[model samples]
Target: MASRTTQILEAAARLVARRGVRGLRVEELATEAGVSTGLIYYHFKDRTGILRHTLEFINDRAERYTTSHMADAAPLAPRAELEEVLLLELQDAPEVRENSAAWGELRASAVFDEVLREDLARATLVWAQEVAALLGRVTPMAPAPALAAAGERLTALLEGLSMRWLSGGLELGHARDLLLGAIDAELARLQGK
Candidate 1:
């Protein structure tokens, strides 16, 4: 059986995705988690506490999701490996889309929330570092500084494309293509092509 804390966090993620972060209520969360409100408060001090764990929970899930995709691409070429990561990151299936959208909403909400802002900044850097390490594998010609910049750029591109794709401004394929294309182009440029 899932722990009560895990159950609460899972329900909180669904609630946050369905109804933005600020819309969650202790009563509703308790009902969804099938636990008493007091139990939730016991596990998490308050609403923000729940939200904090929920954010970490969602991020951890996403990283695991991305890692699953990365695992199979180990034997592929560097570019193909990078594409694997980007494709998973840009996946458009309902579950991935909803998770991405929820995270995006939280990112936006962080603008007005200091603690959340700090958490998001840290979470985002973890992702950026992951991409940078991926880029490091592919961009042999680029210096460390250049690779770092490229990684930051790639992360920005992913974020921009993801937000647009989530908003219906772009299709998932388009987002994936754009990201993969940028990766290829960056590698070529770094190779002095």
Candidate 2:
């Protein structure tokens, strides 16, 4: 039940994920979404508009997905919430895998594109803040340096491990274990244990 804009965004995301942004063409995107090139321009204005909207579309989807999952598990303990949030990153479903790959592609593309760089940095910052809040809630310390450092560490581990997972180098269960282990170790360090 997605709208036309969502349909176009999804198509564009798949194309970008598969071939990178440099490979995206209006005709190809139109054909992929079963819309005319005019419709694409009408919805997004131009190539840059389409690209910006596509990135925002993907970011919004991630935020919604994370929010939904976190909300569903809100009754759980702080550690469980932390586990749910981080483990949600490694989804085995086809759509999730596509999005994960697309995310990696977008992150890579952002290095050379200033606009994308800003957007991607904003997305990462939001996610990191969420992780920091979770770390603060789960750890013995307050939302101070301990939580900030632990959250950053967890975010780095998630990004690195997500790359490995997306490349088929790690399974979801293994990634979950590794994340939990890291979280536990980080908590221990925070507690001076």
Candidate 3:
């Protein structure tokens, strides 16, 4: 069973996924979490506090998910392992989809809310660096600058594709195909093939 704090954060993530940050209300969150507002405040202080913690919670979960998946993928080739990590955002599982939506909500809201920008940027940078590391593993001879550029491009594409998929603007299969195609193309270019 999840602790009260994790329960509240998970509820917050679900609300954020469905309604975005602007739609998240403490009372509704409390109700969804099956806890009192007092408990919510005790755990997180206020709505902003909740939002901040929720973002961190989501990022932390995503990192752990990727790490675990990558660990299980040790027998796979580097490119396959990279594909697994990149496709995580598009996974059909309910929790993965909800987390992707919540993260997307935070990323979109960060533009108008300066408080979220730093944390979102930090999360994005961490993801991009991970992508770069995977790219380095895939092509050890690639220059650092080139690997970083590829990472940034891939992450940017991922964000765009994920938003589209979440909004129903793109199909799941197409999103996966596009991402896999981009990965192949990027690796080919890196390899000078």
Candidate 4:
């Protein structure tokens, strides 16, 4: 069984995804998790606490999943590692989709909520750094600045495409294709091809 903390975090993700951050209520979250409101408070402190923790939890989960997957596919080329990290969130699994949805919500809400901006920015940069590191591995000869720029571009495109996909504004196949194309183009540019 999932630990109570994990259960609460999962419920928080679901609630955040279904209702925007502003709409998430403690009572609703408790009911969703089959836990008391006090448990939620004990674990997270408050709504802002819940939002912060959920954001971290979802991002951590994604990172862990990508790491495990890459480990399983050991001996993969740098390009393959980069591709997996970028595309893993697009998987059709229920958990991936839910996490993506909640992530999108938290990201969108951060613009208006000061409490979430710092954590959101931190998470965003962490993802970009992961992409940057992978890009550096793939293009060992490329200058650091160039690799960083490419990583930023790719990460930005992935996040934008994901948000659009979640909103039904873009098809899954198209989003995946666009991301892949962007990755290819960026790498080609970095490689001076």
Which one is best on TM-score?
3
Candidate 2 lDDT, tens digit per residue, 63-181?
66655665664688988888878877777877877777778877876787787777677777777778888877876556477777778889888888888987779987898799989
Write one digit per residue (lDDT tens) for candidate 4, span 80-187.
878978898777778778878887887777777787677667667767777888999998899988988888899888879989998889999889999999999999
lDDT of each: 0.79, 0.81, 0.86, 0.82
**Candidate 2: lDDT over CA atoms?**
0.81
Tell me the spans in candidate 1 whose CA falls farther than 4 Å from its real position: 36-38, 63-73
- What is the C-alpha local distance difference test score of candidate 1? 0.79
Candidate 3 lDDT over 133-160, as tens digits, reads: 9998999999988899999999999989
Off by over 4 Å in 4: 1-6, 37-49, 59-73
Clashing pairs in 1: none
Q: Tens-digit lDDT track for model 1 on 89-153?
A: 68857777778777887778778877676667766777777777788788766787777777788
**Higher-lDDT candidate of 1 and 4:** 4
Q: Give per-model TM-scores.
A: 0.83, 0.83, 0.88, 0.83
Model 2 pairs whose backbones collide: none
Candidate 3 — worst ten consecutive residues by lDDT sum? 64-73
Instruction: Write down the RMSD of all candidates, one decimal each.
Output: 2.5, 2.5, 2.0, 2.6
lDDT of 2 at 86: 83
- Comparing 3 and 4 by lDDT, which wins? 3
lDDT of 1 at 8: 94
Which whole-number lDDT from 0 to 100 does residue 19 have in model 3? Answer: 82
